[model samples]
Target: MQNNFIFFFYLLAFLLYIPTLILGTFLKPPTKKQISPPTPQSILARIKKGSKYTKQALEDFEKLFLNAQSCDQTLWLEIIKEFALSPSLEIKEITSLQEKLKQNNPNLQNEIALTISVAIKERK
Candidate 1:
């Protein structure tokens, strides 16, 4: 009787431990992968490919603004101008770009606003 009781106790512990291990394997949260931001050259390449102005492009452009302090001012200005003047962009899309510019770099807002206005006029 004593042997039987000990065996059943060990059996119960084993059963519980197995379920705990399985649950732990399944319930563990996934690790997030870190993705690097797009570079100016990459964005320019995308533009050169004649891809339409898109939300993803705008997001990548914003990333450039976030790193603007480390980038060449003149180069970024030219890139912004070129991006704003994209033939594929509609007036509304230009407006969205303007908003993004303002949000990312207020110092350049006025210049970009002017560029966006000119681009809108040219589109009309």
Candidate 2:
């Protein structure tokens, strides 16, 4: 009975020490720095970068149409949709591109036409 009581007393002491062993009682929690939200200028810069990337993608598509480059149909489709949705490209520019695509690939011409129609519908 005495041994059992001693065993329990040591067990209780060991259990109490576990918390201090894992996290020292004297240690302070680390401080976190505040994060600032994006400013208007930063937003504008990002938009400009996106516009530049869109223009470059359109140029790549033009190269493919001109037979100076080639890409898979799925990539072509993505570029077509991106070009159509871009506010940077004018309707007349897309129309001219549609004509060029007609001579190269009917499918791309149709996709461009669909995009143009959507743009027009959105405007109305």
Candidate 3:
């Protein structure tokens, strides 16, 4: 009976302390974290670094169409579609590239058609 009373007292004390500790923590306000502003050089450098996925896409594009560089217009479009859907390149890069290709090839300009054809098709 004595041991049982002591154990019950300790257990009661332990259970009571938990809520106070949690309440103290909850009452405290959160602090804001500081982040340094980006510099022009660093920003430009990051963009220049370019995404690795894009580089891989470019390499894949070259390999896939290596033998058929000047071949059918349709297959070229599919390859370009894959290139554009890559996480590597930006929308502008793909658009500018498509323009340049059209200017040079003329025949393959309207080949791929939409800007994000593959991505749009896949979403469905």
Pairs of residues clashing in candidate 3? 54-88
- Quote the lDDT for 49 in model 3: 53
Total colliding residue pairs, candidate 1: 0
Q: Could you tell me the lDDT of residue 105 within candidate 3?
A: 62
User: Cα lDDT of all candidates, in order?
Assistant: 0.70, 0.60, 0.57
lDDT value for candidate 3?
A: 0.57
Could you estimate the TM-score for every candidate? 0.54, 0.45, 0.40
Please, what are the lDDT tens digits per residue for candidate 1 over residues 7-86? 99999999999999999988978889998877776676666667464446657777656434657767666666667767
The runs of at least 3 residues in candidate 3 whose Cα sits more than 4 Å from the true structure, single-residue gaps closed, are 1-53, 59-69, 115-124
Output the lDDT of residue 61, model 3.
Answer: 44
Better of 2 and 3 by TM-score: 2
**How well is each residue in 1-124 modelled by candidate 2, as lDDT tens digits?**
9999999999999999998877886687888989765433333343346666555555655654333135455544445555555677777876776677667765456665776578556744
RMSD of 3: 15.0
lDDT of 2: 0.60
TM-score of 1: 0.54
